[model samples]
Target: MDGATGFAVSALVNILLSLAGIALSWWVLQNVRLDLFLREPKGIQAKVLYILLSIIFGHGLASFLNDYMSWSQMLGSLFG
Candidate 1:
């Protein structure tokens, strides 16, 4: 992808990842008992942390996916 296209794609990926993170964090907080092993912050603080965690994880996953996809494209271009 060209620079502009790649930038746009990355932006979209970040947005999706952020949303996924929020959803995942919310579900985990609601369904799991984290207080047993962690400090277990409550209220907005807790939610914020979870959301942040999700965003970070999501970003990492997206990065890996992007890398793999790029590698695949490179290989295809070379071999096909």
Candidate 2:
């Protein structure tokens, strides 16, 4: 494959990996029973928004941490 094609493939793969993290985070938050985490909202819309934000932030943070861990491991392997 050409350089451009390889770069595109890598970008696509990264996007998919991040998306998978997001989906898993959303699924776990929605289905996992955690009473403390669920705050009672005054309205349906507010509740929905809260959950949506939570999922987005949770997934994004998880994805970041995952990437960081992978990088750290790679660095350790390179240096050790």
Candidate 3:
């Protein structure tokens, strides 16, 4: 692929991965006892906190996956 096409594909993949990571994180977070940590677990603040935490964790997970993928792709050059 040309540089431009490669970049576009990479961008799409990154977006998809990040979204999947966020969804997965949100699903996983649902099982946690967030109520134990929050003084007003049933309030809007708790909901916002949950969303923020999901985003943070999801981004971290996505970043790690992206880095791992990038490193693996570079391995071809090392082996070539």
Candidate 4:
């Protein structure tokens, strides 16, 4: 697919993945005993860090997979 098509697909997939991640995180927080965010301070710094890290790890994984698959597809098109 072309770049635009790939971008559109990725955008849609990312939106869906984000919703799924939020739901999963909420479920885990409600049901699991991990207490992932309990230790975070109520200060603004902690809130900012939590938000940044969450975004990085959450969307970063999807972005990495998207880029990797694009490269793999490129290589396949070139060699196969």
Best by lDDT: 3
Off by over 4 Å in 2: 33-80
Which is the winner by TM-score between candidate 1 and candidate 2?
1
TM-score of 4: 0.48
Query: In candidate 1, what are the lDDT values of residues 1-80, reduced to their tens digit?
Result: 89999889978876776567556656655666654655655767676766677667666666666678678989999988
Which regions of candidate 3 are displaced past 4 Å? none
User: lDDT-based ranking, best first?
Assistant: 3, 1, 2, 4
Which lDDT value does model 1 have at 53? 70
Best by TM-score: 3
Instruction: Give the per-residue lDDT of model 2 (tens digit) for 39-78.
Output: 6545576557656766687668767866886799799999
Q: Order of all candidates by TM-score, from best down to worst?
A: 3, 1, 2, 4
Per-residue error (Å), model 4, residue 49: 1.6
How many clashes show up per model?
Answer: 0, 0, 0, 0
lDDT of 3 by residue, 28-80 (tens): 99999999988999999999988998999999999999999999989988999
Lowest-sum lDDT 10-residue window in model 3: 47-56
Q: What value of lDDT does candidate 2 attain over all alpha carbons?
A: 0.69
Clashing pairs in 1: none
Stretches of candidate 4 off by over 4 Å are: 1-7, 17-40
Per-residue lDDT of 50 in model 4: 55
* Candidate 4, poorest ten consecutive residues by summed lDDT: 26-35
